[model samples]
Target: MGRMTDQPARWTQATVYPDMWVDPDDDPRNSEGRAPDGELATLADFLANYRMTLRMKCEGLDAEQLARRSAPPSTMSLLGLVRHLAEAERDWRRWISDGDPLPKLYGARDADFDGAVAEPGEIEAAYEALAREQAATDAALAAHPDLGERLGRDGIAVRELLVHRIEEYARHCGHADLLRERIDGRVGQ
Candidate 1:
């Protein structure tokens, strides 16, 4: 949640920490990966890990830092990622599960990232949006348990979407890692 401005040097009590962002013993997100007996369980596990990784990277930052664009020329901020994921979650619900062609969460054409400006109360709002969108999407996915069965007009399998969701989160988590590192010297997870 805090930043190390120098990026090159920061306090790490030891070089070998157990997890990204914190030691495994202290990380709330840390857990033993389960031996999933089904495709849905496996996909859900990875998706949840990456999803929580993003949130963990955002811990303790104020709006200014959250909205701070770590890599210049790229509109990807930690907050922006949060906002984008919120849109993504909604997209999954409307276009994939529900098959409703609704407008973008923020607006058209990357508005989720574009509109991710630093403002008072916006950080909390974005987090809330992400949570809400994820919950709705989760409920929809839970409603249809057959992973091999295709859903919606896209002809994408439920299993495919679940895997895609994990991929999406993992990609964003990578961005968050570099961004958080640059914003402050802290890096991990």
Candidate 2:
């Protein structure tokens, strides 16, 4: 178990997300083929799949392992990524929906990384929270069919929010790759 203040000298370097999760040599967005019925299509599909990619990258790791800061000066671990995404999803949701006025999920601005340290069930809880937030955000988007529908103070279009969500997930998935590699020697996806 990793304590809040105990840092490991040598972190395990392994890759968990395999090539099957993504095309061996193609961008994840285009790796999977389109559905013939087109029912399984939309910007949401891309965003959801990308989020799944990040989750897959951290699969099978214990809480301590997931929380290991494989890369120095970056305070990022699979666990931290999970917590950060959960917080981010909540923030975006609140921004898009009025009357939300909810306090941030992981506490104050810097709390995301602060609460990222390891403990039993921490990993599972973080993942579960992220999944719930993702589902809520998806539902909110579905409720408003018109992409042009303006939401948030900045007049953020629903379409733009969806696109931004996808971009965020895609970028984090890339970070997950390096984090996993640093944890253990495994590498592929």
Candidate 3:
């Protein structure tokens, strides 16, 4: 975004660490030595951190604040990110769990973001849906047990799927960072 000529320019998020989201001590995603060494464990930890970061970014926000499309010209919002991630989790779980390729959550069109309305129940429901999707995905992963196992029509590897899920959340959490900062001056997960 370009700086406005009329209004004073704003800066990107700043914290105790200029180059980091937060100080290492306060950073919630600081897995450090706690993160295990297995492939599955590594992917799971990254995905969990991203998911938790998303939730942290949305905490204490009201429906309007959560739904605010503060970044205009783009329909992205904290609520939209939550809803979108829920749909994504469902899609990934269906593929990983050997479920039929049912219709997409919001259809082929990017209806997920388009339909991200900031209504009363939607905010609560969005978070609930995200939690439900996460639980179902975790249960399915537990059943598989083997990271190298394949699923879906393409014979996609379970490890690949898990990595993709982490990538998805990482991408969206970046957007959520901006969205949350826009909603409130607060920054960091």
> lDDT score, residue 104, model 3?
65
Instruction: Tell me the tens digit of each residue's lDDT in model 3 across 1-189.
Output: 965653223332445665444566766775666667788878888888888889878878788888888555888888888889888888887676555755666666667777778687777777888898889888877888688889877788888888889899989888887776666656544
lDDT of 2 by residue, 119-186 (tens): 86776788789989888877877777788789877778888888888898889888887777666543
lDDT of candidate model 2 versus the reference:
0.73
Q: Which residue pairs in candidate 3 collide?
A: none
Native-vs-model 3 lDDT?
0.76
Q: Sort the predicted structures by TM-score, highest score first.
A: 1, 3, 2
Tell me which of candidates 1 and 2 scores higher on lDDT.
1
Off by over 4 Å in 3: 1-26, 97-99, 106-108
Number of clashes found in candidate 1? 6
RMSD of 2: 6.6
Error of 1 at 118 (Å): 1.8
lDDT over C-alpha atoms for residue 100 of model 3: 79
Local distance difference test, candidate 1: 0.79
Question: Rank order by lDDT, top first?
Answer: 1, 3, 2
Clashes of each: 6, 10, 0
